[model samples]
Target chain A: MRKILLSIAVFGLMSVSAAAQADPGDFIEPIMPPQSINLGMVDLGKKLYFDPRLSKSGFISCNSCHNLSMGGTDNLPTSIGDKWNQGPINAPTVLNSSLNLAQFWDGRAADLKAQAGGPIANPGEMGFTHTLAIGVLESIPAYVREFKQVFGKDKIDIDQVTLAIAEFEKTLVTPNSRFDEYLLGKKDALSADEMAGYQLFEESGCVACHNGAAIGGNSFQKMGVVEPYKTKSSADGRVAVTGKDADRFNFKVPTLRNVEMTYPYFHDGAANTLPEAVDTMARVQLGKKFTREENTKIVAFLKTLTGDQPNFTLPILPPSSDTTPRPTPFSK
Target chain B: MRKILLSIAVFGLMSVSAAAQADPGDFIEPIMPPQSINLGMVDLGKKLYFDPRLSKSGFISCNSCHNLSMGGTDNLPTSIGDKWNQGPINAPTVLNSSLNLAQFWDGRAADLKAQAGGPIANPGEMGFTHTLAIGVLESIPAYVREFKQVFGKDKIDIDQVTLAIAEFEKTLVTPNSRFDEYLLGKKDALSADEMAGYQLFEESGCVACHNGAAIGGNSFQKMGVVEPYKTKSSADGRVAVTGKDADRFNFKVPTLRNVEMTYPYFHDGAANTLPEAVDTMARVQLGKKFTREENTKIVAFLKTLTGDQPNFTLPILPPSSDTTPRPTPFSK
Candidate 1:
């Protein structure tokens, strides 16, 4: 009975320490549940998300890049665009993307709605104009009826399409990770090694840039803070958006949720594994060399951040009408 | 009470007619539910179906061409493949494809498993070899575990992968179309025009090749039997597979189930609309020209083939492990 009381006392102290460590506005927080959803708009968005008819090839959709089945990323070093064109940067995960301060690697688009339009009109991406995309939707009788019901308008527009897609995207938050459970007073949720790794992560100052409900995506940070990040690709990062030479290698911090699934990490997707990524960050960002064991511990902690993935039925799109223009996939 | 008795008499007569039409070894029947599924194999296959890692680029999957969301087809005249290489023929719908006597436009593959292997290795398709694919699977711990559990094997193999994919494909049958309800004695399921079209369809020789629970896919037939098919493409159809002059211009009859959505019809995908395809098939295959009204009625009946699509949660695939080969999508 005395031994049992002693163990209980020790456990109570550990729980108090964890609670004390949970400082408000720290580097992490639980993912909030999605706010009010418009099921009609969401339904329309689901169809649009899967409808590749929006592209010139009629073969690529929002799901092609931000695939829900694969951690909202194509899992390629970079994306394959229209006619197998290689995109400039690594495609970021769209999971919990709404929590980001801005959208895209360079923070070019302000929100998911604005970011949604870039791919459809990009010459190397979906390779179609908003007018052509709208025209395709306009020709589909079922789509027209759906758009009418969702937008309260007789006609379809890119704004309505993007808005609906954004609405759906907002609901893709990943909550209830092991870390979140630990934060919510579940002391045994994480293993001792994982807890140790979390402490090292905090002590090493990695949380300065990666802290938030998203674990990142709240601000822009220089890729090579302490050293240069070498790559053959000549992307100017945020410089293209800001026209500032000083901002040459700065990029919006990508969310770490489901980081285990979103492989080939960073702007260039240079780091292929979580351990490699951690070692690289330690060397380049913190300017510190970690022992092999420390790297493993950090990776273990990172794995606990993987939350539940989004679950939804694959939406079935309506068939094109007689008036719908045929896709010219092979044409120049 | 007298009106109810008269209606009952009429309904009883209609039931008798439907029962009499259900002949043994008939050209068509209502689609049956999927026969005994090994759900574990299906679950693994579902992940593989959405896994782009099967491709050399890691951007294309079985779902890329045979998209479940869009009438089981990519809706392209021909699929855009590796490095943007255009495929020679239109992709066939995978929906209800297991019913076919053989797979592919030329009937080259014996079954779905054989067909699934072709695209992964095809230079213009997924652009990967079975050896490399197996190596990748072997490196992934989760996939290795799954393969062991499903196949009762110690190591991952290409055969097990294909078997699992085929097992999943078997469950893709679309049942309960409006036409099936009509066939099941719900006489009012189809509109008057649709019924008239069905009558014309049976009276004409369209039922000869385009029949069965799949509404086709029973055997190989000449693309243009009574008349020669015109095309800019030089593909020799089944001749390439059989190495016979007699098989020239011969191709497998594709399913007319969901024919309304599988647009750009034929092996060449020359017809862009159902009405246009009806007119062309009438002129070429049956060697009979139909009036505008007759063509409209036939198209209307074809619309009733759109049935309940496969409904399930979008599967989340296991992440690639450290030893897994990184996809060199931009390289040759």
Candidate 2:
């Protein structure tokens, strides 16, 4: 009877341990292959991503603002746009952006495809109409051929272009971060300081909003929950999308992956360094002040979030034909 | 005695044919490897080439003007620069530019490295001083580390930066064109019309200036050798370098390789299409007005020069640090 009781107690402990081990909701998941990844569409999207011909100036491509090179952001406080116009808000990093609950700082778009269409037609951005962009692609024999292969259509459309671009973007996820390695049973993957930062991050309430496969991208949060954040930019954040006064200053939390490379943080890009950004976030969002040593540890941990960047051969764009419209860079 | 004489005759005939076949100097040679190419330096150079952080606006890079995807030219009549300023002269294709007798249309800069420096400081171009650019590089840890490794020095300099970039450009040659294949004894490499065009190109004295490894970059010829070409821009061509009135219209003969892709031809970027360019070149330089058929054939032959482009991964640039100067896209 004592031996049987011991067995039952052992089984109960095993069940509890297993449940604790399997609970992955609090940690950001490592990037993996999505269910629907069309290679043909991705390939086509890559060409479009790099092709500057889509702009009215025949210069700016999707890669111009959302540069795949520098953690998918231009690293500028704000982007330089058509006619060298200054963008009102910081350009968000496009790396792992498909994982976001919605697109843009204000969550203006529902998905990556919807977000792709916004920049092409923005007079301050690419400065080209969707009609003209489609016409430009239609004129190119290579683009037309690839579009037909990918979309099963005789004519290239804006929807097809956006869809292809979004498909490519969905593949741009940085996986195998040191934190992820630690989560995946590698205890020594992170240093003592980084582990401490991770602990502090969870205990300090960062995980409350930042928990998901892409940490911080899965939800919307007010920028200054405690102390009001100051910025010169006039962007109204989620108020633009939600059309409610209560949604003011609420923005989609950006992914922390590769945050080290995506500098000049926040929607306004007011924080110039990681240390400053961490300090501000601690004070404003969590209503807690971190010690200097604690801030340094968190910043160091943030750097470890950087993962392997997207690696691919530069696409050799097909030469423009006689019929193709020439890019007018000097003209409005 | 009869057999001996027959053998002697056959030997003489073979020697004559061999001499004709071996006279490759008069024609452009196929691109071959240079004596030295440091992989590390090339890697650094590529990152620098694609990095817009070099610009004051953080929007322009070497690739912004000399795009590798589009035949190493921006496909612009004149390049757009800082503040959306228009460049006076056409941006030359950087592909096979090392083969040129000197860099730039006027041969103002003696080499590629020297040419690289001008654009960075040019108010109309990148609009950033070398000091500022070097300062920016020093602030970035990744750039600093790479520069130290490549240059064997603790301090980064503009010379090292240009050297690394030039080393990369040395590899940007487009080889293995149909014309090159034909030169290598591929009998049917080109179509009959293209063959006719090649024959006409050789016969019309076009090959006189457009010869050697780059098929044009070897010499500076008067833009209007026979008849004065009109242009609105006040660029004095080689006179800017030579300081002599006699050298007024002399400009570097751009490579015929990938001419099909590098459109809007001439120092002025006057001709928008290949057929128009061929006609203009024949009229202004050779003083020979060709029939419509002749012009078409010449254009067709030019298309045969498109070769294997530089195939490599798009470089991912390092992010800027806090100490790095923020790009003043609106200010300067």
Candidate 3:
């Protein structure tokens, strides 16, 4: 009976700890430092991020597909661009994009600068040639002047354009989440089911591949861990960028910061719910199956990733300056 | 000699005042409050905004289109959904959306709450049915408990969903644009060309149609004041929502806060550049023709409306809890 009492006491203590996990449905992150990463010259990038005049058609903006409101990603499985043509792969969220060592599903671009240059020239994305982009921007005296001041140039150029956009992207880091709070000894930060999910996540060896600052974006992993990914995907995954057969079906592990919001889940965007997706991960990737209850607990834990709403300042373009001599295109 | 000295003195005097009209781009406003919009509940709205798990097909999040990193608006003229299906209208920016009394192009929904509900249920937007939505959350026990605590229910419900999101939306305000600073007595906030544009904006009566906290969104105006909008729109302006002839060519005036970034400007996305759009506005609404010089100055002035960037805390989601119940239907 004394031993039974001790067991009950221990169970009660476990229950107390379990009661504290929040669903993260409230978007509460704790213990985050301000202005953590500053890759200088990013403010210039902020302007480029919002300047749609970079497009040849002058209609499309970079924010068209990858957005911040829904977890740095658009809701579509395949992104739609300038002419409403379908993009090859799912649009990844721009949030925390700076954290990646390489970018895009195939990891074609090395950094944000290289990544910024890709879409503007892509046949389907911005559908604009560099010369055409310069022509449109040069038509407006305001752009011509800002371009020279920003890039030390005589005309609107692509290097400055992409660099400015990349600088802005580097600043797009997500703040503290409920999980962070829980880790900081706010023991009540996670609840019983979320705690169970965490235990499951660890025991299931998800941490083997998904651990670290970005949770998953640190490296690439094969889609089907034990088996091959059984789903149909449009883009050939990592092989498109690296051109290696071994890299086929291997894609960069995306960050789970706002994973709950950045759904259609996976490269092809086939998963529907966190629970269902979690269940699939267990079955296919780990080769360890999750029970219905286990899946529910894991889903409960995944929902805690929502961070606080950010305050975004809408950028306003100024009228052209007269004192500042607007540069004209020189004879080539 | 006295007259020349007097002119110089007048110019010098203008330098000291905050609302300098020394140049078209130099006009400023008085000090206003910071972005004091309470984001407490709106934090929840932001989570809802980004979480694609809410969709039936699980493809899109509100941020998928209305991105903050690239201005509040998305780059696409019309967004594509789940199966590469097309969206009817251009995605409007969430920036200053709270200031708009009515929501959407047609003013179909009067408040953000009503507006939030429509998109979730829209087959093309989120494609979520209420029953299945609840099921998605219920499957996660931690979310189930959140539904119970926040809404006092045991199931995922629509009322709770929209309210939490609406609460989040209220916090999404654009504050302290350079214009706001100029308005608030920051004498040097704007450049000379921008001052000239501000003067033209006031003198041209553009203020009559585009004024208030959002600079426009408070009301609706006919697409063609000077000429009927010179474009074809599959999303028939506002006629589809009201079924009235008067509303045919009428659409909600979008906030010009970040107009430069939300390119392919206008309801059907007819104009490409801010200058081009401004020229169209001048000719059609005011029936006034602008010289290239004037358009340049006005565009510069518009750039002064950009405000400061807010600090955001990105949260990491932890595990879930067992006692937490799924949100119920209409619990709000």
Query: How large an RMSD does model 3 have?
Result: 12.0
Clashing pairs in 2: B28-B212
Model 3, chain B: what is the TM-score? 0.82
Predicted candidate 2 versus true structure: per-residue lDDT over B1-332, tens digit per residue: 22222322332432323323434434557666555889999999999999888888888999999989889998988998988989999999999898898999999999999998889989899999999999999999999999999999999999999999999999898878888888787879999999888778766757666767788887666777777898887888899899998788878889998998898788888888998888888887777898999999989999999888989987888888868888888883
Q: Cα lDDT of all candidates, in order?
A: 0.84, 0.83, 0.63
For candidate 1, the C-alpha RMSD (Å) to the true structure equals: 8.3
- B294 Cα displacement, candidate 3 (Å): 5.4
**Highest DockQ among the candidates is held by which one?**
1
In candidate 2 the C-alpha lDDT for residue B142 amounts to 93
- For A185-291, candidate 1 gives per-residue lDDT tens digits of 78899999998888887767666667679988987777878878888667778898999997788898789889998888998887899999999888877788879
Report per-candidate DockQ. 0.69, 0.63, 0.07
Q: Model 1, B311-331: lDDT tens per residue?
A: 989898888898899877779
| Chain A fold similarity by TM-score, each prediction | 0.92, 0.92, 0.80
Alpha carbon lDDT of residue B261, candidate 1? 78
User: Per-prediction fnat values?
Assistant: 0.90, 0.81, 0.04
Worst lDDT 10-window in candidate 1 chain A: A1-10
lDDT of 2 at A299: 81
